[model samples]
Target: MGLNANDRAIASFTMAGHALVHWFETSIPIFLVVWLAEFDVGVALFGIVVALGYAPFGIGALPGGILADRYGTKRLIVLCLGGMSAAFLVLSLATSIYAIAIGLVLWGAAASVYHPAGLALISTGVEERGTVFAWHGIAGNAGIALGPFVAATLLIFLEWSLVAAVLAVPGVIAVLYGLSAEFNPTAAVEEDVDAGPDEALSLSEFVSNSRALFASAFAVIFLIVAVEGLYYRGMLTYLPEILHGLAAIEGLVVPAGLEGIEPADYIYVGLLVVGMGGQYVGGKLTDRIAPARGLLAIFAVLAVLALAFVPVTGMGLAAIAVLCGVFGFFLFAIQPFYQNAVAVYTPADTRGLSYGYTYLGEFGLGSASIAIGGFVLGEWSLTAFFGMIAAVAITGALISVALLAGLDRFIDTDRSVNANADD
Candidate 1:
């Protein structure tokens, strides 16, 4: 019932690492508002600059995973933390928009190493997979919530560059902590630890495994993750702006204590804060139910809620709060399910690569949301923007249905092979 010492250690370090990764990733959006003012660029140009950083974060994942599988997960993680710390320090010295863009590209590449390394470490290393994934998702959402909250609070007094430097502190500390820590990844499930000659695949062998993974249920899972990434990146990139527009139209009152900060930002942060709970509940559900069933239910609700978000923003604060809370809940709640789905559907030997590809879709292709959001914002209305996101979510729901329908095939294939091997 209780996590052993090793479990606690692994969870603490991995969770801390995840939180810092998110802190760096999400903090950029908070600063983007300031960048626009300082640089005198419109949202479209700003989005391009932001995407420059984001695209590599996605692109680096594939290699990050390959390196993790070869060099060891701990090594890649330390590299990621140290690299991110240095990148943020680079960002703090920016004198021009081009300088800032280059720094973001550095940050993005460094940041890309995290998801594959961290998620792969946990998937293969931990036993209570769902709970660990849930806590991991919570840590991520905490970064999402706090990154902006901290940036906003500091911006009230400090300059943006100084704020960027201060944010680097956690990454530095995490790197130091990682250096002195030890791990026992050998204590994982029997199959993972004993994955035979294919445990560490050669490049050609890895290519073969990757192909097989895609040909099976994992490909459907990848598509679902891609859709989720698009929706997530597209909407969250400009949620504060979207909410600001709605609040202005509906005439919502700002609290006296928070009057100095934008009301929409507070609402944006509040929604993410609420999503922390969603991560917990979603993690729990993964342990109790089939992950596909959970994915189906979550995607379906997300489709409805995504469509409803713009309309609800005009209804009043109560309606906005309720819908946003539900929306935030489901948004994060799906993480563990899909993460769990990856492990269930892939081989023990290639788990690291599996997560690498998973996040490749989740963050890599997901990075396009910045440009997509900008284009829609520049050319279309918020209603149209959210409509497109809703369509993607609905598409993910259909994919989930396919995953569920094919579940038996996935299970039977595994059982049949194992039975033959035993015979």
Candidate 2:
């Protein structure tokens, strides 16, 4: 099914607008650390607060997917952006730590709507689904890359409140773009497919039990992807503190010295950039090479880097940083892989539920990593935490490799038997 001119234009617009939303969300992660400093809150308390901000994303994403499936991707996106903008506006007025939590939950809820809509749009609209998925990834990575830089720059002169208010302004343009574009998913799905609201899962039960994923072949792949999610998020959460620890050990003091750098503070910019670079490279890799092999190699390299993260020096840390980029590249770039794979694996009518399940792996499993990483970090030094991270990456790589291998063996054995039958 070839997409018409209008579909192409809408896809591009949605992609661009979603990029801005991602930038706003991904970059502000560092804000928690900064907010703690600004408000003089306890680190443990702030950790919990930060964790709270992330927790809802997994919980909300499945519901968000359902909304997109039922309501229309475009409308859900517009509403998501509008709601997100409001959340940021709330953030701009916040004074206390609890206010930050309130603002985050609001923003996170809005964020939950985007992935399923965006992924579904890409799946249905694009001819070369992998390429479209890659572009979606690039948009997301670009936003992730830009977020910290923007947030860091904003903090130099303005209050966090003012910064958040200003951040909400871009979403206005996105809302306008969505509204003026004459494409709303909700109306279109009804007109086109005639899907109903009664089919909608009961909200409370849906929210409470969505994480209880059903077991299927596709679901297993999602589980592997979810494990990857845990490593991906876990690695990002602690890399800053880990890198800074290495720098301190190396005595490679910057112009400002140790005080100049803070925990999870100094490396935010580096992490974002690395992730972006990784996605760019990963995009090319996936398009040129098999997604299976590409994912395997990338995860393998990531395992090594995670293992080597601590107990390394100047050149070593720099090398580690670059590998981190590779990790981000393959990790995020492969998102499109799941999008493509799931599309082919599942029937069209139930695409929303399929995509939702995939996200359950990505977001839900990924969220668990925060507490896991935190506990690991507390139990053993950054070095030990990273070792565990490396092990997780190894597990992911093994799973991806095994999946590809099993798929190949099944095909090969089938071919031989068929050849003998013909003879």
Candidate 3:
């Protein structure tokens, strides 16, 4: 079915918001290479410093969710966009590593709100959530693809600071657009909309609700998210550097005018471009099939790809590119499935908090990759790094298998309880 005017507008704005927020988040890795040269720091130090930014991105999700639940999703989203724009402007003006670190922290704090707020909006606001989420994931991948591409391309011709400032322009536009857009923020329960913050769950009630969620199969879902986070952050955080090292082994070079650009940059961007399609397919599959079954298939693929990436790098550029496409496809494809999974597993009234915790695992625990990447690259072999990533993926896949088995039982149990309560 075609989207009506409201669906189109909400999806477009929300997706645009998703793209711009991610654009800033993903572009930082590209800048890390530049920072290493400018700051003359080791990989470990850079990783730790950058991880500071990443940690806040994760840590802030709880508060961001609470705020979203209290105030409204749209307000926090606008705050996110406006705050990120200012943070980038600060990043542009940085004169030292300290300043850069501060900017990154600010960016992290600002960026933190987006996932909870934006996803909450989509979950509550849109009727055809699967399709909208697919499109949203596609938009996010577009940013993921282009952020590095744009940053890499600009670094060749412009200063890094200037490029950051230039990138900030889009966020400004997004904020303006968000302010003017008339979109609905639907609550999971209609009465919840009229209820004030006072009516939100009390501390003990919140704890009880969380316990109920965790006691069921949703606990397995959270574990899967955590494992996926480790792999996701670890692999992507240092991907360009890893690829660059591989290129150096083969003595690869780019053409003139693309000087200073590494083969990894192109490959990384291309891989993410392929992820756009993955997002669409994953979204479609989650809607059309069972999410757990689909998740199992994708996580299996991710495990294989993580292990294969290093081995494939030795085979030459063509093989590496193909591996990247496959890797990127499965990596991103799993997202919408798991996101939809969260919505299904939890009660709707607490979805913002659920996503808050979901991302807390995905981003909070996921932030470990920064330190993991730093230490692995600084002290260990590339084999060890990929090995750890492979292990993480396999572990996640195992948990997902458990989730698949138990999903129906837990969901049915919850429904029966709710039905009995109604009667």
Largest TM-score belongs to which candidate?
A: 3
Q: Residues 114-150, candidate 3, lDDT per residue (tens digit)?
A: 8888887886677666678768877888888888999
Local distance difference test, each candidate = 0.78, 0.64, 0.80
Clashes of each: 0, 5, 0
Give per-residue CA lDDT, model 2, range 346-366, as digits (tens). Answer: 433344566667766776667
The local distance difference test score of model 1 is 0.78
lDDT, residue 239, model 3: 84
For candidate 3, the TM-score is 0.90
Question: In candidate 1, what are the lDDT values of residues 279-340, reduced to their tens digit?
Answer: 77886787688878998898888889989977786787778877878888889888878876
For all predicted structures, in order, the TM-scores are 0.88, 0.79, 0.90
Alpha carbon lDDT at 145, candidate 3: 88
- The full ranking of all candidates by lDDT, starting with the best, is 3, 1, 2
Model 2 local distance difference test score: 0.64
All-Cα superposition RMSD per candidate? 3.9, 6.2, 3.4
True-structure Cα RMSD, model 3: 3.4
